[model samples]
Target: MVIDLPFIWAALIAIAVLAYVLLDGFDLGVGILFLGYESGHQRDIAMNSVAPVWDGNETWLILGGGGLFAVFPLAYAVVMPALYAPIIAMLLALVFRGVAFEYRWRTERGRFLWDWSFALGSTVAAFAQGVALGALVQGIPVENRAYAGGWWDWLTPFSVLTGVALVVGYSLLGATWLVLKTEGKIQQQARDYAVRAGVAMLVLIGVVSLATPYLNPVYLERWFAWPTAIFSIIVPALVLGCAYLLFSGLNRGYDLQPFLASLGIFLLCYIGIGISFYPYMVPPSLTIWQAAAPDDSLAFLLVGALILLPLIIAYTGYAYWVFRGKVRPGEGYH
Candidate 1:
């Protein structure tokens, strides 16, 4: 009996990527929402809300990227050249955001510099991520087992739309997260932002969903064909259900439900993407097996991953549990 090492590694990498998106996503959202706060103190509260777990949340990103490079080098090679611009922008933005996260707290005189840095960095990182995603979804041209596309291949109208969509989506996540983690005027402001962002998110999601199927015949069949078409109905229905929860939670002033529902919407969208890209690590050209490393390497990596993944999860969970509470003015984990 042969173990499907490639499939296992793919699943692990997928899980890591999803964890990064769901966890780091909100902090990025919070940073993106920074400038919207009317007062500097409100910004402080927002930053404090995420300071405890933000750095930790980025661990999954490292794991995901490392797994891709080590376990699926071919996919990494193909994807990197296709997405160099956005990927580089994302990394630089994240670095700026991190530097701002620390430096903003140190000096009162030049703090505004860091404040704008944080906001712009987070926004750019989120946008770059979305553009990279859009570029990937639109498909990279491959020839002779190499990237055959131009340097500007990633920049397109559809990719720009996705970039905008992600910025709005991340803002919604930040707003709802603030609703869950802060109180007083900040919470109220966040609730308002959540409503506006939520509506925009839904509309953008609909537009993206509609446009995505037309990008590839495979996507059209994966989404709209009989048998699999059940997902077409089911995913949207679930999204509607989540939307109801989100709006109702806001209307009723419930704390956690709206945030959870927002997360649900993201999860459903990720699942939808997965359904469309199953069996393929890089769409239009490569399958998981073809992109994967040798079985010996995969097996060795799996042993270490099995040991490390649980530890990371446990640490992340413990941090959140320890820090669970409302972030008031002038109080923070840092």
Candidate 2:
């Protein structure tokens, strides 16, 4: 049935989003943290840590988008048009980031320029994703399976808050990554940042959780349903415990714990959002079945995914394995 297809599509989309958050999230965090501290050596270490895997992380974002377009053309028709401007802005930010990483060391004067590019790009990209996500949550102006409102409709206050929240969340992920990958001073500072970021995330998520029901009563009823509430509480509690372990591990100078904790947090958060949306791909607007491609199209896409998805997964795994271990200085990301 079409219902099964949406669930399948939703699962795929969630994986892509999770992949982006995990892979690109750390690099973006490092970029923001780079601005806070004045240590060139630390910056090099941070950049080196993500260089090998950052590009691959972005692949999933593309895959997610492409797959959505391919498998759910109806969904794309509505969401993409509604989100035209922000999506364009997000792409520009990503382009800036890709180029900046390459040109960062082209010349001495290029240092500040590239640094700003990387930092600003990361900040903007994170914000753009959050805004798009927020707008989806807040409901789109869709009528008869088409986007109704103009471009600026995404610029709501709730969307802005989601943008800021995602930045803070990425910073937490970056700090935890540093805690796992670095040693001595950088690791220690990263630990401090992780703790701070974790605390802030808790507060922000709390506020968001409280506000969501008020923002949309439908979401409130969906989330507040008895069995669903239990699962939601359990998963997030586990995430909180993971955060505690990260702090404890950092306190004890446990190298691997921080990154593991970050991963757990991201996973839990992804799951929570998945639950929040339930049947809707674009909330308050289109249910996933309402937004799917035809059965024949999904079948064709499935054939391609059978080949392509595994290749992507295998290559991604291999790349991480090759880049395993700590990053070293004087080694350009190239």
Candidate 3:
């Protein structure tokens, strides 16, 4: 059988990106919520909650980015130049955040600086990611197989809204994470934050959803067309169901359920995006096969990815297992 290498690579890359968003996302969320915690001890506990696995969570990001460069060179060429600013900002923010993780522990006098560094870095990175997503979804102009838009074409109102929406969404994830990982006053505060962020996230989801179909006629047809229009009903229904579980879990003081439900909502949103961009790698311009590298390279990489991906999963799972349980005052992973 002839292997559909491009499709397989696309799926792998997509999974890798999702794993990065869900994994690194919460830690970044924790960082986003860092400033709101007035008590230094509470902040310490929050940082401890993620420190053991936070850095490791970025492996999937590396895999996703490298896979894109290798497997879809054409898409990469067009996308990178178009999104150079936001992508550069995201990378710099991530670097600054990583430095703060280590340096904050080393100096008492300078800790405040590091704390702000962490929070700002997380916020900027999340915002930039959302902006890039918005820009992509709205469509990148391509002419003669190259980016045709001006340098600042990415900075639209819709992209800014998406950026703000991501900040709110990540804050929700961070708050729910604290609910899962801490106890006592911190948990209570996290619950409060989660409630506010959750409501905001749902509203933004609705706003973005309403606005998305209007961005491209294809999206309009994919989402609101007769046969596929059932998704418009079904996806919202699923989101509402997940929102119910999230709020109910918080109300009932259940730890894990709220976090899981939050993840479910994100997963469903991701699926919605995939539905909109099924055949396109660079939407409205390039399809997966058209943008892919030679088949032989993809097949070779597939062998390596199949082996590497499982090991990464196993390692991540084991780390979480070993570190399972609540983070307490005066104790930490970092």
- For each candidate in the order shown, give its overall lDDT on alpha carbons: 0.94, 0.81, 0.93
Winner on TM-score between 2 and 3 is 3
Candidate 3 TM-score over all chains jointly: 0.99
Segments in model 3 whose C-alpha atoms lie over 4 Å from true places? none
The 10-residue segment with the lowest total lDDT in model 3: 38-47
Which lDDT tens digits does candidate 3 get at residues 1-334? Answer: 8888999999999999999988888899999999988747888898899999988999998999999999999999999999999999999999999998899889888899999999999999999999999999999999999999999989999999998988888888889999999999999999999999999999999999999999999999999899989999999999999999999999999999999988888888999999999899999899999999999899899999989999999999999999999999888745
Pairs that collide, model 1: none
- Which of the predicted structures, 2 or 3, would earn the higher lDDT when compared with the native? 3
Model 1: lDDT of residue 251 = 100
lDDT string, candidate 2, 1-334, tens digits: 2346666767887787788788888888887776665547777788888888888888988888998888878888888888887889889998998888788767676688888888889889888988888888888877877888886889999888888888898898889888877777888888899889988987877776677666666777767787666865797689779878877887888878877887788788777777778788887778888888877777777778779888989999999888887776776474
Sort by lDDT, best first: what order?
1, 3, 2
Off by over 4 Å in 2: 1-3, 332-334
Per-candidate TM-score against the hidden true structure: 0.99, 0.94, 0.99
- Could you give candidate 1's per-residue lDDT for residues 274-294 as a string of tens digits? 999998899978999999999
Candidate 1 off by > 4 Å: none
